[model samples]
Target: MTDTAIQTRQREIASEHLLFKLIEYVEDRHPGLLDFLEQSLDHLGDPADDASKDDAGVRAIAQRMITGARRQGTD
Candidate 1:
C-alpha cells in the first residue's frame, strides 16, 4: 500500500478504538443514549425535513454526544 493509504488505515483504526471507548463509557453511565441517537439520526434524511433542519439536527446531536460523553457524575 502507498504511504497515504497506510496512514488512512491507521487513522481509521485509531478512530474506531476511540469510538468504542466512548460508546462503552456512555453506555455504562447513561444506558439507551445510543439507541436514542440512532433513532434521531434516522429522521435526518426524511424527505419532509428541510436542509436547515437537518443541519441543526446534526449539530445538536454532535454537541450532545460530545457533552454527554465528557459529562461527569451520574447526570
Candidate 2:
C-alpha cells in the first residue's frame, strides 16, 4: 500500500479506538449521555446532505474541540 493509504488506515483505527473508549467511558460514568447528545444533534435539525460534503473536516473540528475541552477541564 502507498504511504498515504497506510496513514489513512492508521487514522481510521485510531478514530475507532477513540470512539469505543468514549462510549465505554460514558456508559460507565455518565449513563444516558449518548442519548442526550443524539437529542441535542436532532435539535439542531438535519444537515445530512451538507454534512456529506465536508464530514471529515467537521469531525476533525469536533475532535479538536473535545480535546481542548478535556484539556481545559471543561468536559
Candidate 3:
C-alpha cells in the first residue's frame, strides 16, 4: 500500500481500538458511561478544535466514571 493508504488504515485501526477500549472500560466499570461520552463527542464541532469544550466534556465524563467506579469498588 502507498504511504497515504497505510496512514489511513492505521488511523481506522486506531479508532476501532479506541472504541473497543472505551466500550470495555464502560462495560466493566460504568455501564452507561460510554453513552455519555458518545453524546459529548457527538456534540463537538470538530475533533481538532481548541475550544476547550471537548476537554471539559471529557473531563466531566472521566470524573463521573471514576467516582462511579470507586463507589462500586467500595461496595
Tens digit per residue, CA lDDT, model 2, 1-75? 999999999998899667756765765577665455544442343347753565556555555544543444313
Top candidate when judged by TM-score against the true structure: 1
- Model 3 agreement with the true structure over 1-75: per-residue lDDT tens digits: 899999999998898657556566655676676566555654544245555536556566555654555355321
Q: What is the overall TM-score of model 3 with all chains considered together?
A: 0.39
Off by over 4 Å in 1: 43-75
Q: Kindly give the stretch of ten consecutive residues in candidate 3 with the minimal lDDT sum.
A: 66-75
Best by the lDDT measure: 1
Q: How accurate locally is residue 33 in candidate 3, as Cα lDDT from 0 to 100?
A: 63
lDDT of 1 by residue, 1-75 (tens): 999999999998899657757775777778887666656654554244555546556657555754555454233
Off by over 4 Å in 3: 46-75
TM-scores vs. true structure, each candidate: 0.52, 0.47, 0.39
Span of 10 residues, lowest total lDDT, candidate 1: 66-75
CA RMSD, predictions in order = 9.6, 9.8, 9.6
Go through the candidates in order and give each one's C-alpha lDDT: 0.64, 0.58, 0.60
